[model samples]
Target: MKDFSTEITYKTSRSSGAGGQNVNKVETAVTAIWNVMESAMFTFDEKLRISEKLKNRINSEGLLQMTSSESRTQLANKKIVTEKMLELVEQALFIPKKRFKTKPSRGQVQKRLDNKKKLSDKKENRKFKF
Candidate 1:
């Protein structure tokens, strides 16, 4: 896992979940923010790639927002938020290997041509040639 301690920032918000009275009272939920544009963890190229790939998840200001309300306890929620932040950063940092172009095998190409010919023959047989 990548280290995102310096990259990400966190904020607490009131949780709306199965915490009963605690949910309404304490701000236990965590909202993790890691702005790709402002992050030192990723390079410019990586940031651009992340911004493109995770456009939906990013806010208008280019900050990636992740919220955690799975746990009632603040510490647990904080941990979850931290882990998720790391995962998000790692995803952004990843460089996917380029795909190599290749042609279909000779046998597969022949099979496809044969299938096309069979289909054409069947269609032609359906028509009563005048």
Candidate 2:
């Protein structure tokens, strides 16, 4: 993976709620945009993987866009967005380890059979004798 830090672009808008007059005057909400298709951070295959995994978050323009208004400061909001982007990209790139099938051991199988036998006996005892 290449350095994605250089590729991110940020936009700001007025934050909503709880900041009183300060919210009206400042553009503190930060929106981070990174174009997956145009990114040099990954190969074509990796880009495709990212696009597929993040299809819902990505727009029609091929940009994976995220916003942060959690912090009152623009820099803090910007930091949050960058962290979100990093986490999302890492998740998209992750490959799950393949699973291998295994059979139960003899002791495990015997335990299951013994439990079933006990349950059967319990039910048999519950039925009225005829």
Residue pairs with backbone atoms closer than 3 Å in model 1 (clashes): none
Regions more than 4 Å wrong, model 2: 1-3, 126-130
The segments of candidate 1 whose C-alpha lies over 4 angstroms from its true place after superposition are 103-130
> Model 1: per-residue lDDT, tens digit, 1-130?
5476677788899988798877779999888888778877667887788888788899898888888989988889888988877777677667789999999999999999999999999999999877
User: Per-residue error at 40 for model 2, in Å?
Assistant: 1.3
Judged by lDDT, which candidate is best?
A: 2
Task: State TM-scores per candidate.
Answer: 0.70, 0.90
RMSD of each: 3.5, 1.7
